[model samples]
Target: MALMDGRDQQHRPVALVTGASRSAGIAASVVLTLAQAGWDVGFTYWTPYDERMPWGADPEAVTQLSSQAVGHGARTAAIEVDLSDPHGAAGIFETVERELGPVSALVLAHCESVNSGLLDTSIESFDRHFAVNTRASWLLIREYAQRFLGAHGTGRIVSLTSDATVGNLPYGASKGALDRITLAAARELAHLGVTANAIDPGPTDTGWMTAEIKDAVLRSTPLGRLGRPQDCANLVAFLCSPGGGWINGQLLHSDGGIS
Candidate 1:
């Protein structure tokens, strides 16, 4: 693994994106978008999570995604780790910094989502959700804020959130906690000049939605279509850019007015 030289490193800011285990996911889209936007990209993925899901893990996702980013002329690093471990955040940052450089942007797109209702959700399931979605996110933000050496007003933190809580109790509840943790950073890390915000990309069909679910979403959504990973990626890339500096401390909905 070769590090970027001083000149190249200085010009292209590094963005660390989580949850890019599969090519179809939003994190993969964010990585490609940021790469095209002139940012060196480092991303994380946990294969076990995907294997447990209905859509099994794609073994070559990281390699293929890295190749795509390199084609866009961006330096890239892909780390595979379980975010449930309490100490995972520090190791992730250490590896990315050593591989690329100091990260200017942190994108939290990783999640452990299993659909269980309030009545049937187990204690272990609930805890795991919080562990990956809430606790891990807080730790990641803390690590980013502490180690951030970017120019003032250039640091960015963007977290993906959801509002679906009816049948998906644990996933939604943990995401709610994540939203607060991320928004708090916008104010708490103000002195560091870091802008933190959460996004709710409603009803995105990242291989989880069934045909019936897709039709229901389309009928309710005025656009009559499902949200795409690229839509959310576009917003993330903008938020990391200098132009999105002013929008902070708020949960923005980029779900095509699906609220």
Candidate 2:
């Protein structure tokens, strides 16, 4: 029961963001950012996945994010659906279009990041990661292109990615897959004027970063402190802008100076 992203003057554009379960997370920031930039936003979230997280779940977070976005003067919609379902993308697009408008931009922000190392990773865990993080994105992107095929000359697709190589096996590996998959998506959508890219937002303090972890990240990052959710949202806003149209099919490291 929450709502909208980009549109022309006659109709505002609508940005659909997935994984907006945390008020303190990037999805929440992206919602506000796009709304400020004049795009109605339609964001999606799942409570079950977030319920098991260290920070626990807040079903109210999505509603709050929606209210905040609307307070900024943009129409908003909050879809509480599980992205892991194969039919999820179809339903999401249908609902967003029905309530918000045509989705001009897609931000695949929903992901399952359990702290499982290689030794501790299970087939079920790995499969779940792939289902939610990779398969869902693939389906959403495909649906996005097909929805506006040959009618529009522009669209934006931004997928969240990570550089985790070892400690976070399943989540990291699935994010890597998402990054590669985006390349193909970009190529396929180039003729239609849509741009697809991925961003690895360094180590953000979304409740997972402890004092020690923050200190460790600070040493590697050029910036003194941990990144904020707004940092990721800012880049995404730019990437979806007219000025960012030239850069496509690439993974830009929005991770400050963390190398």
Candidate 3:
């Protein structure tokens, strides 16, 4: 079978980053960085309004993310899908393959949370979080392996995570699950030349951090600064490169030495 569109037959790898939308979102940053590194991009996005609807629907964020990719010089496709749905990841990857091409690098950056404590968190929230963070990532890696690894003989997957995993934040468990997923999947894809890894961006300044939280996080970091989406994006670009081919099954913490 021939490779897909966003995929380059010229030997340049194609990248698909999920949940790319905002200027400061890691997914968008990854798209720009990957394009600069010469890889075409595909991404998916969801909006708050879509949360009230049924699964498999497109939202406003998808349009925005797709436009940014094209603006950044990447042959881009932005699909709309509710990532919280069980079938969301698979459907999105299928679209990428059908529309963009076979993806050589996959970035699973979809994350959802309500910021509730254990007592306040409901089963609905927990399930939604896991579906987006852990299960969805697994589905993406599986698709990447089956589709690209067979033909091209090499692939890359980078999952976004947070320090909450080790720090025991409410959603930390989900990040931890992804951390384990990266390692396990890396070993499984080793023979196919597919490498899976993770990035834990601790206390990032993604417009979601309040002034007090940012100050506290910066003070605790050895580098005395919070992480930027660009910092994480730079590493992701390298991991998608030929030089990064050997870096598999590792979780890189881009938190300026903050555990």
Candidate 4:
């Protein structure tokens, strides 16, 4: 949830982006894009997860990201939290609201992806993926909608999605679950004034892509290039905007047709 109902204590909208640990990743772009679009932003990062990735993150990247948002003339908050925790959503919403304001839009962009096929995946890893990518997302959306119910307003919910993981079985399956949860939430929460959808960013180079993988992806994409973080960011920004209110319960493809 980009923690928000309408405006904050200072009468500004606040956006909370998850998984913003990497300078080059989608979370960083989401935070900056929302800031540029004129919303005060709050974001989250997990250092342990970042450290485990092949393209490990700079511990200071969150600090740098928040500062950059500040330069965009929007107030910013950065929280270090683990979405894998069962009760993570409550703390996240509370902290974001306390620091920024009530969240009106929830962008569930955080994911835990270990590149393992079905045979290579372990019980531990599969559970980890489910905890972060699917369970946490459902909890966050639930919390966001509940916050809106108390505050008496509307909200936007846009989750990042993918299906092109040929080998990462858990990642693909969990993300598919995310998409289902989002659509179901959209229907269930419509009466409460919330819209929900997901985006397939498709083969984007968010630091994990190698030279060979990128070349192969380029060959497959009709657009003939790998997606940039900003590509997803722009679509997300639009979905959260008032103009996008009519669009609901959709799984959007923003990957330049990689499907």
Candidate 5:
């Protein structure tokens, strides 16, 4: 059975995005795009550790994201969430209800730490990776399904994954798990009207990418360019909209044609 209460399903839909900081982050960009497209939004951020680090998460970043969304004519809310913990997943939904009304669309774009290469990875790293990247995502979707169900009932879940899932170390393996989980859930949720899909942003111009690395990635991509947050956001917005109802349980590569 679908998880949504019948009464809540009848209302206008709103979207909640995790890890919405920085104009270049995928979650922030998705919220902005969704707002511009007329969807109400709720997003979260992590507290920053330092004042000047350009790449770290900041709770206040959501304010800018929300402001931009609202400016686009969509009601918006921001929250502080530590998505690495399984328990925190439920709280995110609560924030959605308290701040933005009922949530019909969910975007899981936030993650804990980024790592690469097998030799550099550790067991602790493996657990940490799954905790934030795979397990938390699964739990969030579980809660979303348990709470929202039905066709025309309103529910869309788009998660951010990585190309590394195809072949790599902890990071790639973790996202591979997420992909399998999402695809299975999509199949189960489809009957009830919800859709689940994964997207890989493909080396976008975020804080983590050094200029030299960005240049290398751009050159590698078939399109001869690195991804933009908006590129991923555009696909996410469409998935959340009524028009994307047919595309479910799929892994979309928004990576500018990079493998």
Candidate 6:
């Protein structure tokens, strides 16, 4: 743990970030960035999701991320929960409030992504994708809205979205639903002064890209490089900040301008 800067820990705002199981993932970057930006952090991770993916789970991810947050003078809490359960969101909020404080920002980065096209996508897989990506997100936002006690204009919700439907039916369709749910919060939660927005970070290379994919992305993108986790993290931090309070109810493409 790092030395405290004499500021009251109780006064610092807390941010709850979802889908932070991988150390190299965007959620982890968001956690670190928020911590450095002076927001105490709480994040959720489900190792089973990562374990099934090509890049296996890192058992120490939570520990390492928590240590890094504390090193930046931020209080940290990490939980492993399967978001597929309808009741999971409420438990997450309860744990976060108990361990940290009322959440000021909620970053929905958790996703169930398995590649299958319209023809091959199974009914079970489609349902699971919607369960984690769409239903869970809506439930989490509802939990956040109900429990939010922060001052008006201090509440934030940012969800990560994508637009790759071809050969990826369930993931893409669920994400489309997610965008609407997140945007709805912006209008519905207006009385609470919370701002909600979704970000479509096109083709971020979080160790899932092959050399061919990398080459194609670089060639298509004007910036001529793959999107890094930090790129999305920076945007998330800003939206959680006082400066980004005005940006709400929109889906932003934070990709490196890939065409």
lDDT of 1 by residue, 52-151 (tens): 8999989988888888888777889888899999999999999899988899999999999999998999999999999999999999999999999977
How many angstroms is residue 119 displaced in model 2 relative to the true structure, after the best TM-score fit?
1.5
Candidate 5 residue-wise lDDT, 10-37, digit = tens: 2446887877766667777888888777
Runs with alpha carbons beyond 4 Å of true place in candidate 1: 1-10
Top candidate, metric lDDT: 1
Count: clashes, candidate 2: 18
Please list the residue runs of candidate 4 whose C-alpha ends up more than 4 Å from where it truly belongs after superposition. Answer: 1-11, 149-153
Q: 4 or 6: which has the higher TM-score?
A: 6
Question: How do all the candidates rank in terms of TM-score, highest first?
Answer: 1, 6, 2, 4, 5, 3
* lDDT for model 1: 0.92
Per-residue alpha-carbon lDDT of candidate 6 for residues 117-219, written as tens digits (9 for 90 to 100): 9899999999999999999999999999999999999999999999989999999999999999999999999999999999998998898888999999999
Model 4, range 157-224, lDDT digits (tens) per residue?
89999884668989999999999999998899977878899999888888888899999999999989
What lDDT would each prediction earn against the true structure? 0.92, 0.85, 0.73, 0.84, 0.74, 0.91
Model 5 spans > 4 angstroms off: 1-12, 48-54, 57-60, 149-153, 165-168
Model 2, CA-based lDDT: 0.85
Candidates in order, TM-scores: namely 0.97, 0.95, 0.86, 0.93, 0.87, 0.96
Estimate, for each residue in 1-259, the C-alpha lDDT of model 2 and write its tens digit: 4643323434567788998889889989998999888788888888888788888888678767877777777887788898788998888889888987788899999898998898999999999999999999999999988886334446899998999977899999999999998888889888778989999998898888878898899998886878899999999999987788788998988888896
* Residue pairs with backbone atoms closer than 3 Å in model 3 (clashes): 4-101, 5-100, 5-101, 6-100
Error of 1 at 229 (Å): 0.3
- The weakest ten consecutive residues by lDDT in model 5 span 1-10
RMSD of each: 1.9, 2.1, 4.5, 3.2, 5.2, 2.4
Candidate 6 lDDT for residue 121: 97
| Predicted structure 6, TM vs. truth | 0.96
